[model samples]
Target: MAATVNIRRDVRDSFYRYKMPVLLTKIEGKGNGIKTVFPNMADVARALNRPASYPTKYFGCELGAQATFNDDTERYIVNGAHDQNRMRELLDGFIDRFVLCQSCKNPETELLVSRDGYITADCKACGYHGDIDMRHKLTTFISKNPPKKAGKKGKKGAAGADSIAGQPGQVDGVEDEDNDDDELTRKIREGAEKVMTEEEAARLIAEREKADDWAEEDTSPEAMARRMAALGVSADSSLLAGDGDDDDEAAGPYGEFAAWVSEQKGQDANGLSAAELYKEADARGVTKKPHRLLPVLFPALFDEKVNAELPKYLPVLAKLNTSEKTVKALGGGIEKLVEAYPDTIKAVPKILMTLYQADVMDEDAIRHFATHVSKKYVSKDLSKKVRKAADPILQWLDEADSEEEDEESESE
Candidate 1:
């Protein structure tokens, strides 16, 4: 009987609330037929708020083995001699990919399969909606066999069976017919009550009456311009523009950069084929304040696998200072990108290293950036991931400092 532990151990704070059952595994069979059995998988999956089958299938996919779960027997098996440590590590990967919300890293999320056959996690904690990586084999399995909803028919059938079993005495045809009628009437009344509560019915009537009034408001360009003025942005603000055109220019540099970013939202890194946006920014002198432009540039320029292309952007990011204000802004932009694509965390270390090598950040600036934790960027667990990614660069900086101090002492 092991105590429950936090699902993410990196989040060491006492207030960190998410927990799951300690993995319980038993190795059975022998030789090539060896399989790892998860006796408490149902409990574990229940805590994670995902179907048990998902993690089971994920184990097979990651290990390159077969997995099976018996619904009737409550058994989960993976065809391998996976140790508890290995299984735990794989389970964390599964949680990162499937269970946790990409934005807040909270387990309070629901899996939604869109009409286009894409899976997304709708987070309740942060109101963030992000698409799941369709590249994973588990995504296909989930799409093919979505979790079944519980039905009321089973309970109704059980209730009827119990009612019949209670009557030991034999009943005539007329009495049986009367019982059926009574049951039908009861069900009808229950359904009718559920269909429209008094409060709900009243609200519906009020909304219908006001629908005409709502339709009368002007939707012309002049009215829209007035509303935009009230919000303190031009009519051509990127926030108001839809995701269609890329060439449409905005009134200011910030707005223009935002408009370009919106055009590249759903596109891949290759789609950023031309350096037109960068050239335009340079022409307009927006390159001087790279920190202000970071929010738009980072997302548009890089994809999930950003490490390979990260060096190409270094010359641009180098123009920005390593001051507190600039670092804070850059951190905020990076956090927003991570929220939308959690996998981007994998490339963060390389990105930081590149920035340091290019003189965009010094040891002091990197240390200052790492010490602060903000929920605006990501949750505690994800913030830990970012810190973990930056550890290599931090270590390098520490070693360099030690070497410098040694050299200074020798000179003295």
Candidate 2:
């Protein structure tokens, strides 16, 4: 044995390695010459609702999720929903949310052990599992790529530089905190921008900066922008799916939709307000009336609306631009991610849309949303149904897997 490098704890070949595969293994089930050495299956599945899975699962961020890995083949699989080909691998500290168990959609999970660990995470909802070696992975990554230290700058402690470690690198005076933060923050922001809006990013920076009760307030726009930009986007293009700005026009077949709903008309009540009427238009998914409301306030808006069909009213954003609309509908969506679950919310669009289609108003999704909601978005009472409609419309995805047909059952 040359070095006997423990891959689970020692490798740092690529920044993207181990991330996606670990996540995928959690959901798709393990694949290798070996099988799960642990006995109980059902007992491990129910640990999600509570903090622990005395038998099947374990609790807390300190504790990692459960998963199985095969030694001989070196291939991993999940027991729940996932897309293996699109999975990513990365350096341990690089922040990213790879996949959610189709059952509960919790992305915060970590696989504590890869080979033979006690705890295993299989979402009770739809039955998904993942694999990760927490301690070994973290230690291995940190050891492989030590942080480059820059010259220790004690020039009047700036608020940011205060908490940063003031250690010197092996080379003379070179602990580049500025460069390090910039690099890390850039990666974080880029990752987030792939699935969120500019406005959303700004808001998230502001929120996360303040959410932590112990953290000092950072209200500066430049500071917030830097923070937002720190959370990098993913290298995976699947996360960047859908049309850009130009494609946002004709976002949907809205003309056909408006035509279909044209027959129904509400009375132009004497005392009824324009805002109320416009809201009605939105509810009916009819933009024509709402577009009409714009002409009164801004004559320029009318110009934007000429042939300004449902969503493509150029600058005037409409619900037809599903991406933007999703952000708009989810009040504080972009802004709250920092204070909210930073990684997950930044990449929640696809999973949310999937859940919306599945017709399942998930409790976990709701709790996550509740945690992310800002004071501006929260209300004392139910003023309207914005939250309700925004709650993903529960639906299911139809997926087919390759499996052998049971000839024994057919013999009857």
Candidate 3:
């Protein structure tokens, strides 16, 4: 394997830095597959009567969302919305950076595997199990250092670069220092400046946050300007306007993540703007941080495709039909899924059998599950057919033993 370059800091600072916390909350919370959950656009539109919040309109967070996970596909499906292409971006960033299982690295999803908090890596080839080192601090340590290959070569080309072991009076007779870019020194200074005592920084940040909140609610430009000045901002302060067009190249990895998300929109699952994603996650009450796909299927789906392509596959998967070429061949019913399910064959598709069976289909569960499908399962092509196939079954199940719940509630 090529020595991986540790862009850990780079990616960490870069990904979704421009995204707001509130918007990101909405993206994760509303989950993904909205179209399937609410086939009627009018119904979906009514639920999404939000005040132009980026997430409510773009990433699918309406008032009354009800999503569920499918046991077979191990993905989420929602009552409205579909944005598989966007979701994958979030997952790829998470898995590539965080999960480190060799089998999961090359996952095989043909067979059954355990996912009940076991540390086994999911094999991408034959579903073989790899060991999980949950107890070890490796994963946690990686958060600080991050799993990376190697650092970029400095100007000296790794040839006796700035090593701390230099002798007191000896010049290492190395590369000329004059040719180095000013950024090198600037970065060093910035790092030192930012590295204040933890307590001091905390107190300062608390005070600043309080000021920021006050500024948000305040309308006077003079007052805002004074607040900005206090925060060490210039009169034409950039951070106040969120840096507008002036890009901070030194923001590191986060520098390119916004552009990446924009370019990746519509092409990846969970495909959302940083603002929209956080908004959805907020409304749905899920993590503004990255998320997991749960149980065995996500780990399986995680393996079946490349990191780049995974974003593309999810939005088109529910329509995925029998492909014996692939071992986990979904039946003919798959393409007919949304239409065939909740009607003809089973009350729920084999895909969703596990959720209700396990009795773990709560709100949060449904939200994540819905996100998975909206991004991965619903296909525009098979959409109507799928609903026609599914709604009746769902209706039957809802009315199963009619008034049973009514009588029970009445007695209570």
Candidate 4:
């Protein structure tokens, strides 16, 4: 019977596509001279597309033990009586750091040795090229003993010869025919060079001069506009009128709010109060169109312990969420916050519940927000966390609707 296990712990399916041989650990020696041997290290490393020495060395480094790999004997050993589970855990860490692509998380990667003596992993699956952590002890070893490049095969022909005998314009075992062909080829080239007339030479020279002159022409905006007009194409001046400052002005309110929030990072919010901030925002006309301020306000107003003091800001946020656009903006801002600080916003359900209870987010909006899943804010894992956090609110809303239906049915 074949023993197999999923490549990663996160993949729980018994029939997962990625499977590897179960770790086979054997203890050797006794007392202080204890050593662990991986008999099928070659096969396991082959499955991972890495050298057996890498994982073996990694185990040594992590466990503070000595490791050895004998290429001739294909033996890998670590100077400790480590259990199979512990070795497998260490191997997973190695795979996460060296084998997997940071961007796509795929294991189809090749280690590249740079000219500057740094190692990078180039992924074949997603074409992602990322620098490997140089801090690892294995990096130094990999740098010293880089993977060899595949050699090209030599063409099956005599040295300095283009074609073989009996092929186009060649005779079998004749050196004179090859030499005569070379001489005749040189003569044909010399005769062809003399065929050009003086007028044709002058015309060629004139065309060259014209090309050089065009190459040296000015490429400024006005010059380009004039050139386009000369070529019978229209150029619109209005398209390039802006001074590239509109985007900067558009971020003014959000930027100011963010700056204010940063300034209040460590201070006690009890002194300043959310009502004071709301009043100040209203004074600055930021509260009039709160959707524009939400992206900045949400993160600024709350931290990881948002649920503890969320009720204080509920009234202010509810008042600001006067329209459908503002509600959607607030939802999007929460999503961004969750993405940026997944750990801090683990109480996402409580935040959403506060909004729903305060009448800021209606049933439709809450349902839509609960169903929406996007990778733009965070990775797949964190995205799932955010969605999972909303489950409680979804359940509450469903129960409320059911109660309302029950009342209607009783009245009928």
Candidate 5:
């Protein structure tokens, strides 16, 4: 028996269960006919739960050489005098692409080929099913010559029943089925026998206890925002408050404040009280930070009735918009309002006009909002919609500014 090593050669964990016979190569022929043969290709393929032809063809693709596999002789040959180390590296690449589960990085996965020539890896270890990268040359070959299905068992003494039984000393179709099951069972058994450290045992116990919570899906905006934060993607940071993790405090200056506002609004019949909101904002130390306040406040206070809600919230809005930056943030809040309630898009003109008349937003703020577009508050497409809906108001503002300039020039 050849020496066995971890399926992932890079993982140096001594207790790692998944193992495969190290690839054995023999250089044959001479000069122009020199070739490399993987003598134990069948054993390695069995360990990976993939066809021997896959890695064989993968080498050919990577080396730009012809590869041949004989089903009867179980011989795999690539038309080149490749070194053992180089072949081993290429095999590792093949395993990473075709064998390892994308979700868990485990070797316990089965390739599922669709009729549409798409390959999906179904991971037994993590119960994850994801599409495999179809750009590799092996995908085309696997799609054309898919893995063989195990033979079905019937009543005793029926034809081919012996093959399906996978009895001892059997090397037929039954061998494929039995070998795979044997590999998985051996891995599980080895993993089960390993001595667990106190920390690892405790962690596993905790995970098992909270498994139900982990299974529950959270599609709420706050959940989505936290997920986006984890991926380092930009979103309303204030929406990621109280993620129930250690990093909750890192969400942003206004995250906890926003969460508090959301909680109060949900409990109170009259919604967020202006006096309480001011105190809360001051306690959260964001009253002076209007640039952050407006973005979170708008989403928390108003909904689709923003056109009507604008006046109702005008007093609070006026208190927050104290500077040029806060005024621009107010503009961003309007965009966020439209994003959250797309139906309010047609009401954008009224909303902006109300804010303008109340002096919550100035001419420069409105002009800045009209000229700039960013996905910070809302998608560019939504921003465009909001700007389009507020176009009449924007045009009027531009004309008023032009008339003032004309009057100034005439007075000069």
Candidate 6:
């Protein structure tokens, strides 16, 4: 029997049921033809419930070497001599990104590819459904070639099987054996059930369809280029879809205008002042649509330095908040900033406080924004993430409301 190790390297329990064969590599040939062959890659991939080609491709991407898989002989090869230890370390990174559940750290995740070419994960262990970071190069490959559906399990490879001790080649789906009830698991199931209820299912489906409106529908050359640009990837003609016809249609007036502003700022040594920005908008015939432009412009204007830019642009933002609609637009603009600069998610409370104090957005607008999520500017999931980061400010706002009510009652 080949030596096996825990699927999760950090899991040192001797009896851990999820196991895979320890990596075995052999360096072949010499000079230019020299390569590393993973002898038992099929067994390891079977244990992880992933295609052998995936890890092979991942190794190629990470090592900057050419990886090839021969279907006839089921051979996996990388065109460079790689040590077992180095390959094992890279395997850990693969497990972290593709195998382990984001919420539970279990290896029971199923990759879900959306029609829009995005990859998400569904954890059977903890019922966490979340987007996998699309920034990785491997995601593009995974999205193009999704996993094949498994056949019905036999008794030996059953879902309830606790250990693969004797069957060293069995799949990894070890269920948690602890008898204690997990509150988080219970809540997640409850939430899922609520969404699936007959009365809400239709509404939920409609919302989901609406949310996908902004997602990519086809793999056209222009579409692929736009998606790659949004993901911060350089355009690669070989990897992209469609024939090499370059269609440079703008992503909409709002996004185009924001891009123009960013380009203009980059070209000019001295940044555009608030008045200069207003004048530029006037020249471009976009001053009337500040509501739409503001959301995309907010991030474009400040890049990642919102703290420094917010105060300087407060007067301009204050002037734009002339009505309730405009105030709500400002709130949406802040949400865009959070979406663009995820590190700013933690600073959501401070951002909201700054805008509120400056009268750019009123308390009522801020409270409403905190409670409601819109897919008009960003994805619903990103909106929820931003709100989650604003919990401290939300709680403070609630407490202040309660105190005001108490004071009014005492006066009466």
Model 2 residue runs over 4 Å out of place are: 1-183, 186-330, 333-365, 368-384, 390-412
Worst 10 residues of 6 by lDDT: 157-166
Answer with 1 or 5, whichever has the higher TM-score.
Answer: 5
Misplaced by over 4 Å in model 6 are 154-175, 178-412
What TM-scores do the predictions have?
0.38, 0.19, 0.18, 0.37, 0.39, 0.40
Judge candidate 2 at residue 180 and give its lDDT.
31
Determine which window of 10 residues in candidate 1 has minimal summed lDDT: 165-174
RMSD for each model, in Å, please? Answer: 23.5, 23.0, 27.1, 27.8, 26.5, 26.1
TM-score of 6: 0.40
Candidate 1: count of backbone clashes, pairs at least 3 residues apart or interchain: 0
Q: TM-score: which candidate is best?
A: 6
* lDDT of model number 4: 0.58
Clashes of each: 0, 63, 72, 0, 0, 0
Alpha-carbon lDDT, every model: 0.57, 0.26, 0.27, 0.58, 0.63, 0.62
| Deviation in Å, model 2, residue 292 alpha carbon | 31
Backbone clash pairs for candidate 6 read: none
Ranking by TM-score: 6, 5, 1, 4, 2, 3
On the 0 to 100 scale, the lDDT of residue 262 in model 1 is 46
User: Against the hidden true structure, what lDDT does model 5 obtain?
Assistant: 0.63
Worst 10 residues of 3 by lDDT: 16-25
lDDT of 6 by residue, 1-412 (tens): 2345677889865435456766667778899999999877876776676788889899999999999997568799999888777888899899889888889787767788889999888876678999999998889999999987654321222112221211222322112323113222233344345434643767688678867884655545565456435522234444443222222112344455565566666677255665556545645755455565566567667656677666656545543444555556666777777766778777788887766543344355577788887876678998888777777877876786675455334323
Sorted on lDDT, best first, the list reads 5, 6, 4, 1, 3, 2
In the range 138-195, model 4's lDDT, one tens digit per residue, is 8998898786542222111111122122111110111221232322223333333443
* Consecutive 10-residue window with the lowest summed lDDT within model 2: 163-172
